[model samples]
Target: MKKKLLALLLLFFIGNFLAPPVGHADQWGVITIPPGKPIKIGMGTMLTGDYASMGIDIKHGAEMAIEKKGKILGHRVILQAEDDGCAGPPSVAIAEKMCNDPLVVGLIGYMCSGGSKPASDIHNKYKVVMISASSTALELTARGIPIFFRTCWNDKIQARRAAAFALSRKWTKVVVLHDKSDYGQSLAEDFAENIRQKGGKILAMEGLTRGDKDFTPVLTKIKPLRPQLIYFGGMAAEGVLVARQMKRVGLRKTHFMSDDGCYTEKDFIQAGGKATNGCYVTYAKEPDPEWVKEFESKYGPRQTFSPQAYDAATILMMAVERVAKKQADGTLIIGKKALRDAIADTKYNGITGEIAFDPYGDRSGSVVVVYKVVEEEGKRFFKQMAF
Candidate 1:
């Protein structure tokens, strides 16, 4: 009996030693590497909605970068796309999903300010870095999340450029309209403040909701204001409606302008048709890279924000490749903090131009130029008219 008891104890000790501790096996499998598993990155953007075209454009740009690089560190790269719908709830859901993904090293987009604000909060929890292609809300940089970076310049810069252009064109009496969302409201405030400081007058400020199809009442009110310029701090989805309504309400002679919110040619020009002609937009300077021709060949013509998305993804992927630490078992161990540091220090000369970040994650050497939409050969096109 003594010998049997001793043998039983020995067996128990051997089992405990050979088997993994209680939850060890489960935990090991959680973050363990499959040597042949492809590295996955994610993109969060609008896949459905009026602004869906912009998100699709950004997606094309990211894939273009991946195609250019082929693979990162000899591992095949997979891109996972998520739809944030350019709004709050969608962004939160995507963020939570991305946080749960242990293999997703980084993210490429949250195209709008409303989406990026909440989504970034979730990313901070996992120390995952995200680079925005089109989000330009000033508060995003002010939020001070080190992991959040953007290829696009903040509205503060874009507003200054717009205000400067308006003043130069002698558009002194301006009426500002906003969509009340983070992106719209912040940009309206910035541009209005700049315009006032530079001796331009803000006659009236108005607000609009995202899905409102009617603006005749506000246009009627603003028509009497007789402002030289009607400035809209919103996307083209609503900008086109406002533009068409302005003309319908006998404000055709007035100047209609907006920030990059209406830079898209597809939605704004197509929907507004003749009304969008002569509308001014402030957009980043177009620096066509040689590879853009290649991208255009595979996917249709690049959208307004596509180039920025390309740079955002390429720089993030380059950072991932630069800092991926290899383990003894041939697994790439990408430390969250290390990847963040690499992005912060990124110096790649991307297709959009030289890419670098400020302490607040805003790109440096950014410039905005104004474009005037004109119809040529019965097709609307953006013509460069201002610096």
Candidate 2:
């Protein structure tokens, strides 16, 4: 009887030793970082192709934030960046790969809306958190993906603001154009709806391919309409081409307006030269001047979405710090659900503005600003106009 009792006791000790500790694996699972190991944050953006500069700017902004906060709970923070190609397929691949890695606690981007829309599903399935810096498609938040959030203003708000600005200027007869990408097409549709509802007339609504350089044909077809304004819903690559070709096709007097996509100096204003002057574009309001100066000093001239990216990264790190618990043996334990809840509850005062998230993971109280490209002292730059 004593031998049998001893055998039973030995089996109990071995089973308990092999089993996972009670708190280590929670309902949503937990991330365990052994001593001296780095905590990873994943970044997905278009590091190549036409929009490479924009993505590079976002990456730099996130890097700046990570560098500013040297470590989190005594563990070094490392950013693992992947190029999403600004398209659906590559973004899906990136999402799958990054979320599969247990070390990655959060994500910072999928710069374009087209990429973000599809990649969001993969992130949601894994319950990993992702915050985009520039993906502004309305449907992104509408789908109720709990893991996805954005620092940029939604296209619905931007479209309404753009339409209101145009109507206020009495440019009622307008032509709307889009690149047919997810971001451009949806924004163009919303703007058109707002214009019609506000008693404006749409002279023509057209779709253009993104990479095609020549827009003279489309401009020539619409020349006879003599619309007061042409609103192009696309990025800088196509935006610059359209602006330049509009002049060539004798639409010189027609006003040109666009969304945040073309709001860049190098790709739009400088590339379009005199054609871009006097044109209008809508983007988020200017960030704090001191913050801008510091960012420019560290990363050259700032691009369109760097400030938003900085805010996103900062907010993510803050949430990570909040939920991370240090173990007795120096191993860090982070509950995935706890981190998500903390992020959704974030109310941060960032360089951009007061940052907060709604239940849908959308940033609340975002402001959109209208800017005009003006020539001053023989150089071109964006001048903020009173909306």
Candidate 3:
């Protein structure tokens, strides 16, 4: 009996030694590799409603970046996304959720300026760093949110550029139409201010809301003013919609001008089949060669915000990689604060332009392009205007 008991004890000890500690096998994977936790980045954008097209473009770009970097980076990358709806309340709520999630170390966007600025406050409080791809409200940079950064230039720069481009072309009498949101109102205000400063006059100004299907009311109000050009500072969808409405109202003489929000190919075609002819908008045009080819091959001649959003995601990834510490198993772990500094210090060439940030987390040396929509082969093609 003593020998049998000794044998049982030996077997039990061997079993314990061979098996993983209780609950550890479940916590860790079967591979027994040291846990180099993957970086988690969150994204907030208007992935639905009227702005769905833009949101999809941004998402596609971001996803492509992750796919391209997944293998090369050693550690896996994960994305968590929520819809901000391009509004204030939803944006704040989404940002709050992302910042509160401990696993989420960084954020990519709230596509519109209205959404991004408010969310920046939430990110600041939580110490979560965020980078915006499309948000361009000047107030976003002015607030001095330390962790807030943007891949795209602000409305002030684009507005000033548009004004100069227009005046250079001698479109002195400019009318302005803006969406009621902060982005539209502020950009149009800046554009108008610049126009006045440059010895031009804003003959008329009009406003519209997010869901307004009929722009006839505003168009009629501005039609009689007869300005040399109409600058619409808002989204591409709204730009196209309003352009079509302007054509419908027999108000086609004035040249249509817009900000970066109106640069995409889809918006021009969606507004009306052929109404986009002669419309101009500011864009960041030098195509991202690395992504453009893959995107073109995947999307088949479709153009979208994939390049910009990809850059935003890539910047975040670079930041994380810079700060991550290798664990025993050769896995990496990065803290949020380190990630922010890495982002600020970044100087890599990105899909957009050089990925460098100014003091206020805005890109440096970024310039806007003015594109004129012209019909060719029964389709609208954006040609870079000389001005």
Model 2 Cα lDDT, one tens digit per residue, 317-340 = 999899888988878888888889
Worst 10 contiguous positions by lDDT, candidate 2: 20-29
TM-score attained by model 2: 0.94
Q: What is the lDDT of candidate 2?
A: 0.91
List lDDT for all candidates, in order.
Answer: 0.86, 0.91, 0.80
Which pairs of residues clash in candidate 3, taking residues 3 or more apart in a chain or in different chains? none
lDDT of 1 by residue, 135-156 (tens): 9999998988988999998999
Q: Is candidate 1 or candidate 2 better by lDDT?
A: 2
User: Which runs of model 1 end up more than 4 angstroms from their true locations?
Assistant: 1-33
Error of 3 at 228 (Å): 0.7
**Model 3 lDDT per residue over 271-363, tens place:** 556788888888886666766878878755544566778999988877776666655677555555666778999898887878789988888
TM-score for candidate 1: 0.90
> How well does candidate 1 score on lDDT at residue 71?
78
Q: What is the lDDT of residue 200 in candidate 3?
A: 99
Model 2: residues with Cα > 4 Å off, grouped in runs: 1-18
